[model samples]
Target: MRFVTDPELTPELIDELVDCWTDVSNAGGSVGFVPPVTADDIRATAEAAFARCGDDDHLVAGFDAEGRVACWLILGDAGSWLRAHWRWVLRVMVHPKHQGRGYGSRLMGAADAAARALGVEALHLTVRGGTGTERFYAGLGYVEAGRIPKAIRLAPGDDRDEIYMVKSL
Candidate 1:
């Protein structure tokens, strides 16, 4: 996999990201949406994420051998001088077909390097409980920093904790 940071948001890249986000969400990945989502359901948000890339944020993407977006994540500034030492990692997604192929890890390692390049000292991310994403982040040297009990409501009475994780660089 090849990783790139702050890549240009071409129309094709946006489409690929929306497709990947849709697939991951439908496959039970703890992205922003629930299962059974369509590319239309994710396009707006994906484009918004793309817009965040620049001086105050970053978009790191990993591509497959065919030059398709296989995995990606965003590093966002806190927008406060007091919190500038760290960044928030958001919208982490690996194309379902690329899962278990180590693309996720490679994407994260690239994000780490990108953050370090920005002189960041830590990374913060959140995962919904019961998705097994905790273990994945833990394996990447992240630790549980806090949790908001039953913070995410997927549906009626189907709530999950919002787990806050952090990695100190």
Candidate 2:
């Protein structure tokens, strides 16, 4: 697997991003929104995000043996007022078919390097609390910073807590 900073996210990249999002949601990744999320919604969101990446943001993509995008990790510089010394890991998703192949870690390692290059002091991300995914982030050197109870409403009748984690560069 190889990591590349997506300078311009074309329609093809958007399609691949949607596929990865759908697969993760269906597999209960709890990244956001929820299962049954439409392709149009995913495309619209990704397009907007890609447009924002034009500034001081980095979007890293992972390609598989076939040279197709298999995963993506987004890192955005912290706002000036908030402190430019940090970069927030916005989204990290690996296609279900590509999960367990170390693509996620590869993407994360690339993001960490990108943040360091941008003079960032640390990287931050939020995950769903009480889930096994916390262990994954922990293994990546992200320590729990805090948690917000019932912070995310995934489904009509379901609510999940948010776990904020951070790692120093």
Candidate 3:
């Protein structure tokens, strides 16, 4: 996987990300939107994430051998000088078709390197509980910092805890 940061947010790149996010959500990947989502359903959020790049935030995208986005995530600053030592990792997603290819780990490794390059000391991210996403992050050396119960409501009866994980670099 070849990772690039803050790639040109052209229409083509945004469209590709929307498509990838749609597929990942539909395949049960934890990337904000629920399953059965269309590209249009994810377009606005994807655009907003892109708009966050170029300043204290960055878009780290990993491409496959064919040059398609296999996985991606965002490194976001908290917008305060006091919080400059840490970055929030958001919207981490791996195209379902490429899941078994280990792009998820590689994508995160890229995020780690990117954060280090920016003089960051810690990385924070949240996962919807019951998804077992914490285990994946733990494998990469992230520790559970805290959890907010019933924080994410996918539906009336389908609520999940929001697990906060952090890694000290």
Q: Which candidate's lDDT is highest?
A: 3
- Misplaced by over 4 Å in model 3 are none
In candidate 3, residue 9 scores what lDDT? Answer: 84
Q: Which residue pairs collide in model 2, if any?
A: none
Roughly what TM-score does model 3 have, to 2 decimal places? 0.98
- TM-scores of the models, in the given order? 0.97, 0.91, 0.98
lDDT of 2 by residue, 12-129 (tens): 8778777787778777776565667776657777677777785777888888889787888788767785678998898788888888878788888988888887788999999986
- Pairs in steric clash, model 1: none
User: Which segments of candidate 1 are over 4 A away from where they belong?
Assistant: none
Evaluate residue 25 in candidate 3 and report its C-alpha lDDT on the 0 to 100 scale: 93
User: Candidate 1 on 79-109: residue-level lDDT in tens?
Assistant: 9999999999999999889888888888899
| True lDDT of residue 1, candidate 3 | 76
Worst 10 residues of 3 by lDDT: 47-56
Residue 163 accuracy (lDDT) in model 2: 89
lDDT tens digits, residue span 1-169, model 3: 7899889988998999899999999998888988899998888888888898978799999988899988999999878999999999999999988888788899999999999999999999999999998999999999999999999999999999999999999
